[model samples]
Every structure is written in C-alpha cells, then in structure tokens.
Target: MAYPWKSWDRALFSQVAGRHWPGAEPVLPRLSRAADHGRLWGAVAAGMAVVGGPEARRAALRGAGSLALASLTVNTVGKGAFRRARPLLEAVPVIRRLRRQPVTSSFPSGHSASAAAFATGAALESAGWGALLAPVAASVAFSRVYTGVHYPSDVLVGCALGVGAAFAVRAVLPPAPGVPRPGPAVPVPELPGGRGLHVVVNAASGPPPLLSPPAARIAAALPLAEVSECTEDDDLAEQLEKAASLAAGQRGALGVCGGDGTVRLAAAVALRHGLPLAVFPGGTRNHFAADLGLRGVEDTAAAVLERRGARVDVAGTTALDGGARGAAEPFLNTFSIGSYPDLVRVRERWSRRVGAWPASVLAAVHVLRTCRPVDIEINGRPRSVWLLFAGNCRYSSVGLAPVRRRDLADGRLDVRIVDGGPYARTRLLGAALTGVLTRSPVYEAAEVRRLRVRVPGEGVHLACDGEVAPAPRELLLDKVPDGLVVYRGRR
Candidate 1:
C-alpha cells in the first residue's frame, strides 16, 4: 500500500543522513578552532564579562568541560533521536571534504555546532582562541552550504544550539581560569624560564657571499654553529635547509650567519622542523635583521653566542624569481612586478664585477627612459598602475644599506604601488640608489595577508628581495608570525 507520508518521510530522512565518526580521532578542525582561536578569544571574553555577574563568573569556570560534554550529548543523544539525511545526499564538492557520512539529521551542522559551542565556551574561560571561533565556525558552515552538503538553515540552527549550550553551562558552572587574580598583571614571558638557542646562515642563497673573507666576520661570533660553504652553488636556501634539518632533527637550538633572504629560508626550514632560526644578515639590505634589532653581522653574532636574543615574528613572500613577477614557488622579501624586478636583475647580474652602484646607475637610466604603466587591483578593487612592491618588512635605503625601525613586530606585509610615469619613474630609479619607497595617494599603500596581482598579458618579471621570477600577474606574499628568530643584543 502506497503511504501518503512516504515522500515526506524520505525528505526528512535525507536531511539527517550520515554525519558521525567513530573510534579514535586525531583532532577535528572544529575542536582545534575552539581551542586555538588565540587573540579572537580576547574580545569574546570582554563581551562575556558584562552580563554574567559575580555569581555568573564563578559559574563559568567549567567552560571547556561543558563545551565537550554538550558536544557529546548533541551528537550522541540528540542526533539519534532525530536522524535526517544530509544535503550532500544530492552530491556536491564541498561535502566531499567532510571526515565521514553524517548519520543524524543534517538540520544542524555538527562541525558548525561543535565549533561554535567550543569557541564561546573557551572564550568564557581562557583569554586566547575564543575571539576567532565564530568566524571559523561560520566558514565551516559556509563550506557546508557552498558544497551543497547542508542547508543554510541547518547551519543556523547548529550555531544557536552551540550558543545555548555555552550559556547554559556558564549559568551553572564556576569560573575556570584567567580571572586575573587581584594585583599587577604578571608577564608570562618575563617569568623565569629557559630559552632555546638558534643560529642561521644560508651558504648558498645568492647575492649574500657565504664563502668570502667577510663570511669569517659572521662565523667568528657563532663559532659553535654548524657551518657550510656554497661550494657547488646549491644556493643559500639548500645550505640552511640542511643546517636547520640537522638542528631540528637533533632537538637542539640553532645559530646562523647569512643575509635576510638566507635568514628567511633557514627560518622556514626550522619552523617546518619545529626548530628556531637565527640570523646574521649575510646579505645586503639585511632588512629583517635590522627590524629584529640585530644591528649588524658582528654584533648579531656576539648576541647569539652571548645569549641575549629573543624570538621575533617573521614576514615572507613565496615566489619571487631572479627574474620579475610570480611563478610556481614563493619568495622572501619585497616583490617587484613591473620594471623594478628587471632593474634588480640587471643590477645583480652586473654587480658580479662593478659593484652595486654601477648596476644601480645603469638600471635607473633604463627604467627612467622606458617602462610603461601596468594595471592593478588593491583589496579586490580594480585600479591601473605600473610599478608595484610588496614588502614583508619596512626598509629604507641608507647609503650602501637599508635601515628598519626596532620593536615593530606587527605581522603584516607592507605594500607600495607606483604608477608608470616619467616623474614616478625618476623616483623609482632614485629608490634603487636609496631603498626607501613611501606610499600615498600618488603612491598606493596596502597591508594584507593575501593578495593577487593580475597582469593583462603573460610573463611579467617578479623581483623578490633581490631575486627575480617570471609569471606576470600571479604573486602571493605571506606573513609568517615568529617566522624567524634573529639574534638580538644590548645595542
């Protein structure tokens, strides 16, 4: 007999299909987001402080415990009671990323629910990670919807469920932690603790001489560091990668002697291997070294050997070749996507014999006479221009070197875009002589985590730091907080 409610039951069942995982799990994205939102938790805690009175504060102590328990109940208890199929029953790309088939009703996204509940709960207790939870939760939900894995309404309900769980627990439990027990705020870092040692020196990273007499100037201070010369031109990066791998693999700290680009490469390898990286600024500019208060190679070396340095955040670019523009890999340092990269390559190639001045003078004249404007878009808004530079660290040229301010550790990339013009061209040339480039209405300034430069044509030359790559419009510069540890000193 054909049941009148057959279609209705099928629709309902589809909404609650597969969404559960059994047995041991390493870590869920929702759970990780809940625990590690870091700074985002700050704002959430601030907002929470208002409504919950003294009694409320005391009750909120078990925030993490409650979040975990509530999540357990929602999936284990509530899910079975209302089994429904997921939106992915229809097939979609986004849902394919999910860990398992959601068995319970898909009305509420479990990932979204768990993420929201945990985020709010953690914010109520811990000072870090709470703030970013909401956005992370939202993204998870959006991905579900975008991929046709779940309905928008399900995500909404899931969010509400998480919020409700947080408040319920907050109203009942006692204050967990981070209430700032009356008195001055004690700095965790200043407290007594041991620090790890680190050193970096990329022997093969080009431009920075790792085997010359001056190289001794860097090695003298870090006599204890593992040293290798660029005998076969493996490049500074390959050298540091080896050194960093050895140190990290050994579970020991490291020290280095090299330029900013070398430092960045070593640091990346170190970070990947769970080791710290130190810098000697072996290359010209040494932009990051200056920003980290390294002063110069000699002093920087002394500090690493002496144990006066501390950890500082790092900034980097991924794919800048010795040519200009973008390519398959990323680069470290400022990227030039117009005439600027070519100018650097022209200078770098010639500096082999004549030194920087002659190369600079030649590139300056070439750019001043030629070089046309190129189109650009800042923060998704389209605009046209010629010269563009994105800097991981701020630096202005001082004679033979570039100088950066000390104590500026904000994790943001600095950017400059100059329109292709004769007067502007003149300024670009002057900057090559002097590494300072400022942005204003005449010159555009942008600070961002991710951005893309689209060239109407193909194969634009990309110059990074001092190296160059060719790909035209495709370029991505990433900011790595605590990217590299530079040796700091009293000076």
Candidate 2:
C-alpha cells in the first residue's frame, strides 16, 4: 500500500518539522488553532463587512460562500474519496504542534482549502482585498505542515480544490461588472469644498448603520456645501424641489443623501430644473449608488469637485387616462405590482420597528401566506399574475428576483412576470429554488423599450424605488433615455 509520492511527502514533512525558525513557537501554533473551523476567516469577513464599502461587502459575502463550498466538498467528497493517513509526528517540534489534532483523512487539508477558497473568492471580486488576504491564506496553508498534521501534497491539492470551488461559486452568482465607462460625459461645474452644492439629507434613511451620520460626514468633507436635513414631519419631495430651485438659482448642483426613493425624487427635481445631481448613498441597500460606483460620501464629493459626470437612463410610468398621480413620473430602480407591492407595503409597515432585513423576512412570509393574484391586461391581453416586475434596465438574476443590472443606460425595461395558475406559487417557488425559474412555464422574463399594463378593477397601487403610490387603471411604463445627469467617477 506504499505510494510513490509517500516518501517524498514524508521527507518534506520531516524537513519542515525539523527546522527552527525565529518567533515560531508562540505565533504559528496559535494562528493554526485560531483558524480551526473557519473562525479566523469568518472574523475577517465580518470586519470587512462592517468597515468596507459595497465592494468590500460583496467580497466578504463571496469569500464566505466560497469557503462554505470548499469545506463541504473537502469533507464530504474529497476526504472520503481519498482516505490518506495523517503524517507521522516523530520528527516534529513539540512546541509547534496543534493542541487538538484533526481526525479526518489527510489526503486534502480542509483548512488550506478554506483559506484558498476565501482568498481567491475575495480577490476575484476585489483585487485590493485579495492582495491583503493572500498572505494570511498562505500562512495558514504552511501552518498545516509546520504543525506536523498534513503533507505538502495534501495542502497543495486542497488549495487547488478550494480555488476550483471559488470559481464554481462565481459561476453561480457572478460578481457585478467593474465601474462602467462614463456615459457621454456631461459638462458640470467643479465645486471645490462643495461650494455651490445644495444637498438634502434624509435623516431616517440607511440600514446596518454607518460609523457616523451622513450629514456629519458630508459637512466634514465638503464644508462649504449647503446641507439641509429632512425629518419625518417634513415633506421629502417638497424639500427636494426647494433645494433644486435653490441650486438652480445659485448655478450649483443638487445633492441628495438617502435611499433609492429619496434619490428618485431628487432626480425628478434636478431634471426639471436642468441641474446636475450628486448622490450620497445614505440608505439601506444603496442599489442605485452602488451601480453608479459611488461607494460613499467621499466618492460623490470627489466626482462633484472634479466635474466627473454622466447621463443615465430613467424609467417612468404614465397614465393613459391622463391621471395626475402617474403622469410622467420617473423611477430610478424598479416598478412593480401584484404581490410585490403587498410585500413592499408590509415591509415598510414593520421596518421602522424591526429594521429592514427583519421586516423583509416578515413581509415575505406574510405575502407567501395571504397574497393573491391580480387580474391585469398586458399589451391588451387579459392575464392573471402573481407579480409583475419592471426594471429600468435589463437585470441579472438566478431565479424570479431581479438581482442587479449590468448596464444602466441600456434604454430598455427588464420585465418579469409570474403567471397565475393552479399551484402557481408552489411551482414558482420550486423552480426558483431549483435554479430553473427562467425555464419554468409560469415565469416569463424579457427586455423591451416599453410596456403597457391595465388594471381591470379599481385603482392599483404601484411601487417604484421602494415608494408605493396609487396608479390609474391604464398605465404605460417606459424608459427616458439619457434622462438624468449625475456625478460618477471615471474608472
């Protein structure tokens, strides 16, 4: 049962164990133990999530996912397939050995695999983070041999497996593309220290919390900028309108710090007044800001000071009956109806009390239990649907939910519909869970320049950019190409 590589692996393990290095007794063993069961990497991921921007958050999530995949594969398949024995510790230094040794097969090192997977996954999303984590990962891999627990070949194979797992995770959930090229750069005033910039701050926005209040950060970064705070008692749209008017008179840029809803309102006003917009992401899940590559207040401030700007498309809804409520109203992110509007309603109702993530979970459960289909006309064809989603641009998704968009100014609507039928909900959920929702008969996804939707009954509520409003029975959803000009740093 002696393998040809066994002698070489043994000899290498002896060499590593027999060597004496400076400062090796106290640190390496403790580091190895700290990495047991993926604790070290988990702590690193948490730190990145708390302190880093959108890219950092994405890197942390991707790294954690990849680690999980690698660990699962190593334990369930790799180890069982090759039940190699652990290396003999006769030539090992007692001080460097782990207090509690691993009991699994030693053909592939689980710790090494997890480290490689996390580092590779994070690097794939963000090179800067990857560069930082690579050394830690390498150290952990080398520790396996230094502790006299695994052969070098085992560590190498484990790293290879880990890398493969990270790539597999990427294939399932691809990272968003890098900063898009500036779209037809528009001329804008370079405001130093945010002079001539008027910004309205929504004090009630944001989730997961920031290190400091956005207003304070903006004030510190751009001292000369005129900042106004809007509270619950204040009317948001009205305040934005007033700020836009003021900025217009001063020949300055209008700025908004809030969620997608607040940004959407500011955009409408900026477009009306022919003023460029600056967006500071101060909201829960700053989807629009992240897509625009504005990671924080500093990014938008830099863009404004440097006069870096571009034009992006905006989508809106108009009532065929000429109702004021839906007359040429613009939305920056998504518009949806049916069960989804109900979800948004429920989420908003409880978000203030329980927070956004918990509220979403509660709303999802509530919708799944009590929500029903709505009768509507799609392009003059009668249909019953559980949900209808229209995105400003074509979105990427693995299932029924629209995740993110690859292009902002695609000049098209990404429309997805869930047809109502017998066991429609069950079928839809099953398909989504199985990653076959796109192929399911009840699900339909397409991209178009315009969409016409009609409600057969009384007024239906429409949700745009997380804001819910009443809509006329007959409605048209279409894109306004190159509609809003906003500051975005060039890549």
Candidate 3:
C-alpha cells in the first residue's frame, strides 16, 4: 500500500495539473477577489478550547501562532530573501491557486503555510484536538484558493515554511503553562515542577524533536525542565554519565524524551544508576509507547517534572564478543533474522525521506519477492519459517483494517512467522488497515521465559531493540520479567 500517493488516483493529479498547465483559461479569479479571514479564524479559536489542559491548550495556540508567523515571515522576509514572483502576477499563469492575488509578493502561501503549521503543531500536542482543528486550518488554506488568491504550489511551499516555523518556536520556548502531560502509567499532579525537567535530548539516538513539532511539544512542556542536548558525536555513554551524576545527587525520576533507540540509551544509563526512568513517545511507530496507552507527545515536560510516571519491563538480548567470549546484551524491541535484516539495510537508505512505515512497506515487498524461507525451532518447536520474531511486547497493527486482539500487558512476549501464502498475507494486511492486530496462521503466541532457536543459516543476523548483532546457529531468547527499570506507564 503506497499510501497518500500510490493509493491516490493518478487521474486526480492529472486533473489538478491540467488546470495549471497549457493555455488553460484562468478558472480562478484575480487578486481583487480575496475574502475575509476573520470569520474562519474565529472557528479556529473555538476549536482550541477543546484541548485537554493548560499546557495542551497553550501548545495548540503557540503552534498556530508559530504557523502564522512562519507564513508571514516567509512571504515578507524569506521570500524577500529570494525575491521570487507569483505565477499570474507576472502576466502568465505562474502557479496554481484557486484564490485571488495577494497585495504582496507570493513566494509562499501564508494561508496554506499557516494552516498546515497550525494543524501539525496542534496535532503533535493532542491528536484528538489536532483532528478537530484540522478542518478549520484547511478552510483557512482553502480560502486562499476558493477566493482565487494562491496556487497549489504556493501552498506547498507555505506548508514547509509553516512547519519549520512552529518547530523553531517550540525549540526556543518551554511548554505552555497549565498543560497536562501524559505518563506511561501514572497521572500527573496539579503543580508544575519547581526544580525543572532533567531532560535527556538524544539527537542521534532518535529523530530530531527540534524539527518534529510534536516531539518538540512534549519536550518543551517539562517544568523547570533543564534540557541536556545529546549529540551523536558526543559520547552517549559520557552524556548519560553526566545525567546519572545529576540524577544520583537529586531526588525524583529520570526523564527520557526520544524514540525506542533513545529510550534504550537513556534507560541503560538510568538502569545502572538505580533511578526510575520516565519514557516519552518520541519515536516513529513507537510500538512500545502505543502498547502502553501513551499518545500525543506534543509536550511531556510537565509529566516528567511532576514525578508522575509509570514503570515497565525492559527486554534484553545477549550478544557475545566474537568467539562467544562475553555476556549477552539486553534489547527493548524485536529480534529477527534473514529478510528482516536485509529490509533494515534498505530502510536505512530511504527512511530519511518517505518515513518509517513507508520504508517498512518497501522492505516487506522486497522480502516477499526475494529472500528464501528459513526453518527453525522456537520454544523447542521446530518449524519451517520465513521469519522469526521475538518481541518483548506486542508489535502488531492492522493499519486501516480491523484487528483480532491486542493485549500489551499479557505478561508475555510474542513470536510469529511473518511469511506465508496469499490467504495469510490477506489476513495480515487486513489487520493493519483497522488498528486491530491479529495472529497469522504462521504466527504463534510463543510467550515463553526462554526460547531456543537453532538457526540453519551459517551466520544468524539478529536484531534486538532494532540493533543488529551477531548470533550463532543456536540462538536463545529469554525474558527477564520486569528486567530493566524504565519510567513509562503500564508495561
């Protein structure tokens, strides 16, 4: 499913593009026909009231403001930096716009840019509120077109500018006052933290929150939350060493705001220091975060500073030093072999542009067509398998289709066979469409304390916590049962 594109009817693009190209008569009106934005903006204001707490509300407002500011800045400042011209104003159908002409230069569509910025910023903080605010944002943008003011291309550029501006604003400011934060498990307190948030911002460990307004929202919300930027070049071990130094001397929990990769990095530091680690959903899929009921990470500072967090079990995978000389290592996510590894390789190449899920789909299709199946024994049961997944928690989603069952805290890891015939393929695809995870005929609930899989391949490539490592033919999977101490909500 090449969504948002592949699924999009190609004809629609042809129709839209047709209007912009050729000696097409101007379907949109001239600049003199612009409409009033006040009425539509009032609707946007009404929608903001529906947000959860003071922090959330503030974030929504700030996001919108940032979005608007970005639009204005680009149209006035950034565009001036480039001195670009509007398509039609130059006497030719320059760009596509359903709206009329703007009094100023039109390198960026302020309406489209601000609308996208507001929608993205708001959604990052509260998905529920974000969804409501979206249509209003759309109407604001659509106004530019309906009034014959801006073109489609102008809005596209504006969208980029707006999103950038929101992120830039969020990076400089703290979360809005009175906004409530989400905990992995616990409810937040009324008062903000007096000491500030001891934030561990790992840039390399995961995606950059500074660019992702949603992730930025969560990080900015922490109280008096002092942010410690963790750069990839800097010694992660050293940075955490410093975090532990501070946490060890202070009172309260250790807050980690990043993806699964970041969590593992920070959690490792927190685990060694004997401090309770709090988790924020900053990763792409965030299977673990979703399983625990944490959503809308637009802002998480308040929750962390308040010491309102939950605890969960961490998964471990032992890796040996070449020649099996050392102890095993622990991992938080899934471990797999064969096709999965190859898929990761391909994803590493494309994930930067399309995103994680899209990369995963590309990987899935690649594996389905190429990689040969594998035969292995899991939990002492031998079977011919195409893929063997050992998950610490549930890693299943049905996309747009209905799911079979979802039990995150069943207190067991899941094992499954990833490939099969067309019937099995249909079942798995159906599950993703509906957010309803299901078991495949090739899949089994192999939630055991210890599992042994004798790999048939010469060198078994394994991934634990999305980290690839070496494994011999005989691979053992075991659960520590509340193994590592992590600060999040329910396990």
| Best candidate (score: TM-score) | 2
C-alpha lDDT of all candidate models, in order:
0.53, 0.88, 0.55
In candidate 1, what are the lDDT values of residues 237-343, reduced to their tens digit? 66666666666665655555556545545656666666544566666556555555555667655655555545444454443333464423334456667767767
Q: Candidate 2 vs candidate 3: which has greater TM-score?
A: 2
Candidate 2 — which residues are off by over 4 angstroms?
1-30, 46-54, 72-96, 104-109, 145-161, 189-195, 207-212, 321-326, 361-372, 396-399, 422-437, 457-460
What would you estimate as the lDDT of candidate 2? 0.88
- Root-mean-square deviation of every model: 22.6, 4.2, 13.8
Model 3, residue 467: distance off in Å is 2.9
Which candidate ranks first by lDDT, i.e. highest?
2
Worst 10 residues of 2 by lDDT: 396-405
lDDT of 1 at 429: 49
For model 2, residues 1-491, the per-residue Cα lDDT tens digits are 35689878888888888888788778778888888999999999999999997789999999999999999999999999888889888888788878788888998999999999999999999999999999999999998999989999999999999999999898678888866543577898778889889999999787645487888889888999999999989999899999888888889999999999989988889989999999999998888888888988888888888888898999998888745445588998899988888898999999989988899999999999998888899999998999889999878655455757777788989999999999999999888666677899999988899999888777578798988887678889999988888999557
RMSD of 1: 22.6
**Sorted by TM-score, highest first, which candidate order results?**
2, 3, 1
lDDT of 3: 0.55
Model 3 compared with the native: what TM-score? 0.53
TM-score of each: 0.49, 0.82, 0.53
Off by over 4 Å in 3: 1-197, 205-220, 296-299, 319-328, 353-357, 379-382, 394-409, 418-441, 483-491
True-vs-predicted CA distance for residue 70, candidate 3, Å: 37
